[model samples]
Target: MAMTSLPSLPLLPLLLFAIAANVALGATIVKTLPGFEGELPFTLETGYVSVDDSELFYYFIESQSNPKEDPIMLWYSGGPGCSAFNGLIFEIGPLAFNITDYEGGVPSLQYYPYSWSKSTSILFVDAPVGTGFSYSKTQAGWYTSDTKSAWQTYQFLRKWLIEHPQYLKLQLFIGVDSYSGISGSIVVQNIVEGNEAGVVPRLNLKGYILGCPRIDATINDNSKLIFSHRIGLVSDDIYEAAKKYCNGSYDDVTTSEPKCYEAIKVYDRLIKDINKYDTLEPKCTWASPNQEEDMSRRALEETSSDDFILSPPKIPDMWCHNFNYAMSYWWANDRSVQEALGVRLGIVDNWERCNKSLQYTLDVSSVLDYHKNLSKMGLQVLVYNGDHDLTIPCTGTQKWVKALNLTIVNDWRPWIVDGQIAGYTIKYSESGYRLTYASVLGAGHSPQEYKRRVCYEMFNRFIHYYPI
Candidate 1:
């Protein structure tokens, strides 16, 4: 295949200014955008599943890609309450709609300036119930939780595969942020173990990929401390003070630590008062003079706050304040429209509520014992993390993987691509798969959005050329 070259630009002052403006605005340009123009159309087959007398809405995205050698990747967002379709419309898929103009009849699809459809079929599912367009009307509390939803999602995938024989050989489960680490593991484990026992027919069974996955809840809890320590958010002395208040308990420490609470209170007050502050989407960008003034206002606000709050607040503070986290809130708040389907959100919600009747098969024991159980079933596991993400810091992930005590076949070292610090890589050959630690430069939680080229390369390495 011939490589497409980037468009050449003349070395002019205006061009330089435009480049500088983009850089200043922190806008990322994806280099390898696909050639297919306009909205990548799809046919949605809507259905309902009866769960506890409630009808739940569920639908799948059938990619309009030719040759279709690229497998179907089931994408889920985090929040356990978030929608997978949001991931489809905003992040990776071919076309995204602007929901800001919903009242206006002008319906337009914004082509992904960069898309991943060239190499894979994408399926964005609204899982459990009460998330996105999925909801439970009769069984109000049926689909409100996480574990039960995992089971329903697994069954849905199985049935979906059977119905769509064309995609049976090309199904792969993939997720990122929170669900990628949690529910994603459940889906992969189900396929692997079921295939081994001869109870469930194995589909294509390609390996899974998690971008900044939130796997272990316990590990994620501790990441707060690690991030606080790495960045100068809280001094070592302040952390020690907060730790004493926590009474050595990691659970709910944020509630116990007065000093930590004070820190957060101070930070929040500062954040609130920062000039040019936008509550919905707070970007870390302002003119230098305005930034200084904002910083001063923040300091004053922190100083004025009283120090006697119950627990320290843990605001979402990170060095890189990208839009990934902010986008989640915006997407979740949109309870009226379906970006992927180009229809009212009401239709989809009904289907999700019906599917609320499904239940989870695996428990905490199964999740904790995932590595051992899945390996025995001949399934390969890949756990990956981007190093720079303070949200799901790489250090916490390292600690969790090390505690797993899986035999290490490949030693830990930096995985470099094109002479850049792409990330670190590790492998456990005895376990029949490789574990990669990719460090995406200038990336926060969602590396795919921030570092697309490197992320694509890593995906190609793992999915296309495994066992290397």
Candidate 2:
């Protein structure tokens, strides 16, 4: 029997995991990885899904409960350029970086008490060829669009299932958030079409999940002003005046409208200091052309994060809240860490949380039609947003959801977590379809990062079709 092996002492664990997986394919089972103090408690497999010349990398974590029985989730990161590691370490993965320090080395890994993988198997993917550890063999393979990404992802899923036949029967969900919302909708549609065509290794495609999805840029941008006004960021005079002058055209304002431009300018200045993604949290790193965010010479340090961990950076009181992401940047880019994860060298010059330099094209600007069609299908859907997220405001999600026109199964009400009001949620059902819309109160973009346990509880119940 041919047995796949990884480097070092972890090979024994890898062999065990491979035997358990039944079909290893070209996957690497990681037992001991960098950052964490000791051996991992759960099984993690890092491998590539071939999509033509491009190799999309993914981190697969088996369910800690019952690997064979638990449902599977394909979690694609948003940003169209951001790595899926955010959804992994920060959002739902089993292990996460303890972000309590700032001394700037490898961020130590710790077991999250409410990891999504406790009962649900998750596949965190770095898609579109250029995100995270995923890369293309040829330069031409890097250029991708909304439509192309969906098809590629579909093909990837099919091939992945073919390789790991044991997991082919698990109930599947395509989970996406942020800018990937556009491609995510298209991807879901592709899966539905594939299933209808009677494709090989038939997928038990159940439903899809969206978190703070940027469904429509026009609506999202316009709702920014509404969200701002509702949160008391701007005065009523400015808000009403902009509405009167701008005519709800936020993205493409005319040069002729000087008053409107000035109003927007002031609004931008006011919120420029705010981290539009998560208003309550620290404003992390943002890149610029002249100089990079973290140019630390003390990088590639993966010995032990305990020795280097420092207190969290002091957030500035002014317009800038500098929550430096040096720790994560260092941890991911470390040579030892990459080797431990079995990452292909020269695939990417560096690992950025969000590879903003990818040549991604915006083919589908809005997913209004997709959401409407999904609502008609006999599928369960959950659309959640951080109420404080100004980028893809819940107001925009609410507007599109209202457009779905489903019967109100449950009227709007506050949902509780630990006896405190966590957020507001509403339920809708039409035909065989059931949709749940929720808002994570006082949380900014990516509610999972802000309220982990609460978001996990929300997801756990939503997936099981229980009351929120």
Tens-digit per-residue lDDT, 305-374, candidate 1: 1211111122334332322333333333343323433334444432221121232222342244564455
Q: How well does candidate 1 score on lDDT at residue 400?
A: 67
Residues 1-468, candidate 2, lDDT per residue (tens digit)?
Answer: 111222344353454355446536568889987778788999999988778788999999988889898889889878776778888887888877765543456667888879889889998889877778888888678777788887788777766766676787889988998888888888888777666765544678888899999788778878888888988888999888888878887666666899889888877788888877767655544431111223222211222333222234443342222233445568788888988888886556577776656666777778898888877778888889988887789988898889888999899999988999989999999998988999998877678877888999999888777899
Provide the overall lDDT of each model, using Cα atoms, as 2-decimal numbers: 0.49, 0.77
Residue 85 in candidate 2, Cα distance off native in Å = 1.0
Q: List the residue pairs that clash in candidate 2.
A: 101-310, 102-310, 277-445
Question: Against the true structure, candidate 1 has what lDDT?
Answer: 0.49
lDDT of 2 at 130: 77
RMSD of 2: 7.5
